[model samples]
Target: MTLPLPRQRRTLGRTGLQVSPIGLGCSGFWGHRRFAEGAAGRVLATALEQGVNLLDTGHNYSGFNAEPRLGRLLAPLLATCPREQLVISSKGGTLTGQAGLGGTEQRDFSPAAITASCEASLRNLRLEYLDIYQLHGIGEHQITDELLGTLQRLRERGLFRHLGINTHSRGTLDWLAANPTVFDVVLLDYNLLQQDRAAHVAQLHEAGMGVLAGTVLAQGHLLPYRPRLPALSDAWYLARAWLKPSSRRLMRSASKMRRAVASIASQAPAQTAFAYVLQHPGIAAGIVGTTRTESLLQILATDPCLLDAADRARLVAVFGDGRGSPSV
Candidate 1:
């Protein structure tokens, strides 16, 4: 079946890269137990056909297999299409030492590591340069002057069209804003579950930085199959068996609450979550990851016009505002 085309493109931070308002996160296409070799190419082709011009992946995803997978898939497509028509993004500052369900681990962001990672990614991606190269989350100690200098040099050399950092910390966002020219984009974890970064987002936008949102699905906890923790009551368990996490651990009361929220929100989960992020003023795009081609297609098929205030309120009630209370 044919997927719906995106209606508009958004400017990617200050890089001036125009991308589909919703982009594909390529992590799901690699390292997962269910991801097949050919699936990545199929999904990517489908995404392009559906008018998704932005594809986000990282070196750490799938033990460095993600970029290569994307390269194999995108090579043929790139040969035919003008390179400027697509936006490709990848991250460094982490490494996948092994390949398995959870073999990936974070690496330090030394200047040497950053430089080495970029060169390796270029080779893996089979591209002369990346459209965007983001520094995955790193501690303050890791964000050294040397590393920043290296990023600046990479920019000067045209190794990447733009530089960015991905983080969930407000302090990091604040720091990056203070030194705006050091980075072009900032990928943050923003969703209905967390609004603490709302103010930071506004700040970044004011500084002319691109803001891309990840974890919009909260690492799949918001899906129908999330497992219940032991703390949850039997009533909650019964109500949300379908939403159980892939791995069932000792349930927690918070698990019950989470399941309750998921149950209520599942009626229109994708619509609610996607709309919640899209409503944010500074969000250039929402980076959604999914293993299922149909799920990606569903996101593409959604009518941007359907998200309304009532839907926003329902999402707020389910996930709550940054404050401890539900926005409802």
Candidate 2:
């Protein structure tokens, strides 16, 4: 099937890289038990064909299944697309074992382990250099001289063009952003519920570092709170959370918020969530993970400009304006 390409492209902060406003986050490409390889490849091919240049993945996602699956799709594309035409980003720091399922993961940021991780990734990806190489999930203490020196050495060897950090911690993100010379990009979880990092994202962008928003869908909490589309991850989470009253309350609150967003935007809750993240002025790209082409197409079809002055105000009122009220 022929798909229309997205016309929008934004600068990835000061990296001088231009990418589609929305990039495919590939953590669940084949890591999620629900995603098959053929479907994952189709979604990827569709995204790339539509001018979405940024592809985000990590070594530990899907228990090490994610990167190799991505590499398989990319290998064929490399035959036609020039290496520089695509912006591939991958992270490391966590090591997985046995199968792609969780349970036996361990953190290893030692210089030797990091070096080995990059070399292994290169072999898996069948590529000479990555566009963006990030430190997976490191705390401030992990930012030692040894780690920084190792990243620099990797860069000098042409292993990657730019350095970035993908952290769940706002303090680490802020610290790295403050030291702009060490990192070129920042990827963090930012959604309505986790707006604590929103201002930091804008701050980093202003400091001339690319900021990519992850978990924009709030781990599917922002997806349409409907019955037919239950998520496997959500089900597993809810099973554990259901036992606790506080977790139940949080789930109920999230459901109400989703419904409210749908009513306010006169759009599907998922579409509204995608629109919300893409409209952020400082966000270079909002990374979305999907296993199906239909889901990807829906996101690609969303017009970031769909939200107007009043819609923006309503969203801010509903979700709070901690991330600023700039329209995209």
Off by over 4 Å in 2: 1-5, 32-34, 97-105, 229-253, 321-328
As a TM-score, model 1 comes out at 0.81
> Model 2: per-residue lDDT, tens digit, 1-328?
2233468779998788888888988775345545667877888888887778888888777667778888888887787667777788998888753222322246789999999998888877788988999998788778999898998999999999999998777669768767876789988877665554667878888889999988777666666645677756556544534553333433554655565567754555667777777778889988988766777888777776776768766766665633321211
Report the number of clashing residue pairs per model.
Answer: 18, 0
Quote model 2's TM-score. Answer: 0.86
Model 1, 1-328: lDDT tens per residue? 3233478888876788888888989874343334676876777778888889988988877556788888888787777777878888988888654333442245768878889989888888888899999988765456778888888898788889888888766678778878877778998877655655677788888899999998775554455554545322333323333343311221221243245445543335665566667778898999887666787887776554566667556555544533321111
Best by TM-score: 2
lDDT of each: 0.70, 0.74
RMSD of each: 6.4, 4.6
TM-score versus the correct structure, for each prediction: 0.81, 0.86
